[model samples]
Target: MRNILILLTAASIAACNQSSSTMNEYKWPADVKPPIAGKEPKEFIAHGDKRIDEYYWLNQREDQKVLDYLKAENTYLDTMMSGTSNLREKLYTEMKSRIKEKDESVPYKDNGYWYYSRYEEGKQYPIFCRKKETLDAPEEIMLDQNKMAEGFKYYSIGGTAVSDNNELLAFTVDSVSRRLYGLQIKNLVTGVIYPETITNVEDNDIAWAADNKTIFYVKKDITTLLGYQVWRHELGTDPAKDVLVFEEKDNRYYIGVYRTKSKKYVGIYSNMNQVSSEFRLLEANHPAGEFTIFEPRKENFQYSIEHFNNKFYVLTDWEAPNFRLMETPEASTAKENWKEVLPHRKDVYISGMVVFKNHLVLSEMKDALNQLRVINQTDHKDYYIPFSETVFAAFQNVNPDYNTNILRFSYTSMTTPRSIYDFNMDTQQRELKKQQEVLGGFKQEDYTAERLWATARDGAKVPLSLVYKKGLKKDGSNPLLLYAYGSYGYSVAPGFNSNIISLLDRGFVYAIAHVRGGQEMGRQWYDQGHLFNKKNTFYDFIDCGEYLIKEQYTSTAHLYANGGSAGGLLMGGIVNFRPDLWHGVVADVPFVDVLTTMSDPSIPLTTGEYKEWGNPADSAEYFYMRSYSPYDNVEKKAYPNMLITTGLHDSQVQYFEPAKWVARLRELNTSNNKLLFKINMDVGHGGASGRFDYLKDKAWQYAFFLALEGKLE
Candidate 1:
């Protein structure tokens, strides 16, 4: 490996001509060259297929050569984007001004307390607080995360639980940005944190038993980062003496433990490949009792359980593709003994359910939109909470009481701020508790949002949600940004983003493409977008971009694309499929080396996601993945301007994936378009931990787009 410092110094002198009056006239000096990684060819032979991967040496995280390359890439990114430094700062300040710094969340009543979180004027983290039984009661500070995170560069608080006696608080903290949390118990009354800390536990896996002294949590596999072991710990006892309550032997399944909303049972759930799941239950009162299987696991069968009034409600996809609801007595816990509560509708996908004493709430998806259905358990009558916007998102909020008629949920659209509401199931009335406050005189009336459908090559209608400033002309000259995440059955909702207002105010249209790999249109949508049919996801996004161009919303010269993680994979795919469709692209923590990563089970999500991306061990699946893999398919062609970002500590998609991808793209690309990579040394998959700090990354991304569009005023 060459000394990067010497090369960078030489390139800096050669690229000194940075006096362009407009961003569109800027160009890289012919003598200046980006850092070139050495090719160490590694051959992977599987199923009689031979593939040689260069830049494979970049995966050596401990090697100084690999570190030098990554640092050089970061330096190159800084050098290339130096001209936009002022614009980036301006954009950052513009976006940050819209946020209300000293804000508090709407309090929700739970376990005889009104719980909420609040942020101080200049704090990066929130303070967890609660009031006893009434809104007007004296506030009790549960946890001051800003104080706890004072010395850490990256910090996050995961699941938190108050003991049954309300004297102790169990919380998980992750300081390394790897999603491996450390469990700590705090004495709320004395304000003393216990000395015993359990390490390597999964986030959001902490549950308190009724005894209050005993709590259950899932431990992760150090290598794969899978939470496979459930353990029980007693207060004031050494964590080394904790008992292993359950261990999932299957590597394909991840497990977690939680207490039921009714407070009657503690359940451990095991989910496999997103296609099958099984549950085990133990009476909450019996902290020492053994768990009994709620139902044995079966292939392609998935069900979730909730308890209420001595009966267990089950949401299952047993014979329905979109899922249905069923119920059975607590004593007779078997699929055969279950009776239908709500038959599955072909058009409506039941995503989740909440059980209450007198009413049941179902969160459903129809026409790529969220719908909240409330049903009276006594009268068996149901009604949906109506939303006027054609493209909006609604989700059930915290309703821990299980005995109240009031259902709390959140609603938001592209043009609307996120608002919390309390809806009465009995009276069919709704009360607005609070809406997110956008500072700097923000007004919803100044913006407009609409839904559009694009026709794919196979005649599939892909939904697109777009928002822009009012009185915008439908001209082909406008700049538009398209985003999507079409994988893992995760739907990209048309939610509100106050940060996007900066782009809207700058005459840029922001849109979300609800492509096929997501569950936006139900299970069938996901089924068609993954595995052998994964290319459909990329095609759908391309079609949406073309549709916008055809409708005079934007043209290829002014179109931009952005996606993160799996959506980053989408960005990689689309750029390969149709490089000329985008003027600029931003891929954050992308998974681009698909065939190689899928073939290695040691990777974090490889084995568990075989069903989503086909198992490459099979010969047929190998060829299919290779057909569209961004890294494998990189050819000698002109490529779009790209900004690739990654975190060195990212656990979901290894940082090496994008590092290797940038090297390969630069090697094969024949165009002079900007190809830059930025690596965050302190963060993970989710960028910076601080609330306001993340906006800097967003501002940098927006600056990239604005610079390309010549809007860098």
Candidate 2:
């Protein structure tokens, strides 16, 4: 392999219950032992670097020993958590009690029907229903997931679309939790199912053409699992005869298909990892017509389109890092003809938009808080909906009708419940539609949320969103759990979650670090934390932990770190960099083997993520990834207590990554502190599918933390 110095110059450097069980109740029998995976070294050579992976054999999912090992780990986890069985049950019950047994979502009018979903008293799934003409009309049951999921142990209903005539329903379902949903059509009036089934397609990329019988769906790449092909299938015909509408040949882009809000055009969009995108449009009335490119793809140019009248409104980052709004004639859809409608600002980020007849609602993020800006296009005036909370998330909700005076949006915070509201864009009046019901005496006044800033090593200020019970003291004695997911420019909203009530009630401070890897602070924040500058994510998180301690919010003895997936990678980095800062760490399905995983193109997300986490084939990226990858940096010294969890069939972060990390940690760690590993046999990346079943896993996790604190009573 060649050295990186030759090409380095051109690259831009972006930037729960506890339970104290009765000692006998929770303790595992001393005879039972932890699983120790046997190693057969495999040489991985990349960028002229050779690394020996002893646990590479664990990746062989079909091997009996691998299955036995995963099962053994599960057994060990159960035995270890047995002492906290009572606490786990109590936590589960408390969490479940807070959720309303029977709940219904707010109905939003779309086309001619008011659509919504509701749950029965004890069902794990929801029943999708709709009312025609008015809310008082008879309710029609489109699909009851409770019935479709009766036989499958794991099932999920993804995106759903109704034809223009409202006679047929197109939906996707995943039975194995791998995200490969099969498309099925249902006749609403006849109450019959179409025989044709489309398999191996994406869950959220389904669109119905105006013809009602023609549908466009995205096909997932069998090997990479990337949505790369858009196919059109005619109802009643075999899926084998589906015509390929478009295929994204670029390895860097992912494909998606959807209908415009006007329902006038079906669009196919190819989004590059992060920097660019290309969109194609086809009139909905002409299902068999070719899709014309809205704008040719250009490097570092990202834009999204929405059709309105005779023009296309675009949100692009052409010359603005924070993004701006542009409009172009529908017939002359090209970058050269695009005219600026809303210029970008340095302080505010245009996150999203929802177009209406006379107004345009933009979801903006400013000062780390979401602001809903309602722009009256007719009057050329705009105003923001006010929010009282210091740390909260607000975004446009379901507003399907393109012609409406009401703008539906949602708002929530750590203490506040998820509430939906309808605001009259013309009258400037807001009406509360529905607020989430939290049973078991949950009160927003009992808790408080605040925002803090942590100064990073580079002098950059990273925002931290925190929430805790009122009347708590800043004495450095409180136990705190710092969490974050600083990757893919995905911001972790400070949203409400009823389950967290248990922790707040027990005097725990939950904090989310708005690290550089996320878009919380803007595109620059994300750019500074990715690729060669990836270490900023880890450093930002560590700084937040340190700031919490310095301000007396928590102490090193009572501090805990929690993160999953990429955030799990943060946990791994922090524990390796500053082991003494945390008492315990919970890494859920972590991506710890960065260099090795990125080097393998066969992995699910490796190929498309080359731009995000530089391709390891390049020596510069290879050395940089190895420098911080958790598995490669396991040191022969004391480490913090840790509980690592993974699922056998995870498509995102392969289960073997965490398994191998744990095995290596067991071999090198010099600490006697607790180290546990668990693998869910029946589920994938997201864990249990059932509503209550998912809480059981959480109950077990909470019990682990409580046990560490000696608070399990």
Candidate 3:
């Protein structure tokens, strides 16, 4: 379970006066003291194999020793990096300068109101507002997040849904950053809060039924934190009184609730990792009625349905690896009743679909590029919304209304700002609604984006998307940072990021390895990189780095690597396999302790990922996982300079994984190159909550790269 709809400040702290310490100057390979984790050996024996974990005590988060060790690590990191304070501030300022302080998202219409979110000059939170009927109407503040977040160090607002009459509003909030949210309501007309509250529900996942008073939301597993049960609640009632409508018995499957676009049915979706899925439907008009299965779940079956024109349009991988579209009458819900609407293509992957009154929009990924196609339902004339860039990402934007012929979508590339457009399907014309405002005179022409291919050991061509300053030479004189997240079939799109401009302008080349384990190259690509074939992911990344060096993009001395979460896992894998290839590495909340974590079923995502990473209880999976698990495979050898980060409250990839990892590396690593650890005591998986503050971490990381290159001034 990777969250699909998962959605950080700087300067003054970096300038804080440094306190005197034993280490007078920052030195690489210096005789410095690192925190030594206590050796409380824990024996793990399975499948006739035995191992001892010396740092296993770090997982006891509630113990005082663990907290003290983490704090000590932070202190050590700050001391080691004290010399680069100025560079950090300079980088932070430069990165922050590109952003527009006062910005508002494009307003979208839903029901009778036009809604949007805007940020003030220096505010860290968004002000959600809406106007009735027309844009000229007076702004009604739906949620003043700035005021609500006044005293909280970390805060987030989850999904917000308004009543049918547009009077009552519901939203979820999280102050601890653990993904557990508190549900609350407000009377939009009266500007008053409700008395009812729900605790420990999943983040922002609620569906309002037609009754306006009843809503459906999913409850998380108390210990594991996975959304396993769907609950129905009525307005003004105690959450304890809420009815449990559905509970997914299989731990491998996760449950979620959402209302259909046509507003006719409320759908409850239960899915396994890209393998099998089942959806149940309840008539929105009859919220109290029991939901019925659209079609029974079958082995290897995967389908997502959208209601349109008295029919259910299904996008499924049943007998079609790339997925195809089939339609069935709303009243008859069975695979036998399906009629092919769009035939499957081996080369094209239908990522998603949206149905309109007169048109149907398909988000197709071909050659690692997203393409938007609009089909006229009545005339059967289909055409693509043309894009100008050869390497860009284009997908549907916020489209709430189902009756419009104009399709709203967003397009962006490594060089282009995020551009929103409204395409008229009837007239075959596109109107630019808005483009992200990059203040301080930014231009797309200053950068270049290119796609390259690297041959893996097995001769499989791996795609790489790269961007750099215009006229960048292939000579190995520039600094290059290679990044990848080769897991869970997640496609990392080559989208624009204003912060990256700092690197490009500073003579750095950034490349993303579209390796296996991601769906960018279609289903087969992902299949080959996971489970028993997982080694392909690490091998492909290493080969890509080798390819870049062979082509003179940059030498190993100037090369760095980065990845967060599962991508952090990539960072771990690559470093373990080819430590000499990278000069520096940033592993953000890395899942380095894969073998041990997967051996337990109580961890948040471990059980559900059995299909993704095979169940280690089996002898073969255990042996295979142990062979490559980063922490398990860490050797007593010279390693790259590394900065490992973690969050105290991270639900996914617990902080201990990295904490224990740093401890073991410190004990055995033969290199004196920096091995720094920093833990955000307040936040979770997604770091700092503010927009500007998030950039501070990136600035520090870039500053680290500069320092490693001996260019810090």
The most accurate candidate by TM-score is 1
Q: Which ten residues in a row have the lowest lDDT in candidate 2?
A: 1-10
Clashing pairs in 1: none
- Candidate 3's residue-wise lDDT over 242-353, tens digit each? 9999999999987789999998899999999889999999998899999999999977899999999789999999889999999999999899999998998988989999
Ordered by lDDT, highest first, the candidates read 1, 3, 2
Per-residue alpha-carbon lDDT of candidate 1 for residues 425-449, written as tens digits (9 for 90 to 100): 9999999999999888888999999
Model 1's TM-score against the true structure: 0.98
Q: Estimate each model's TM-score.
A: 0.98, 0.96, 0.96
Candidate 2 Cα misplacement greater than 4 A, ranges? 1-32
Candidate 1 regions exceeding 4 Å error are 1-6, 10-31
lDDT of 2 by residue, 23-141 (tens): 52333234444667776788988767788888887887787778877777776666666667777898999999998979999999888899999989889989999999899999999
Worst 10 residues of 3 by lDDT: 1-10
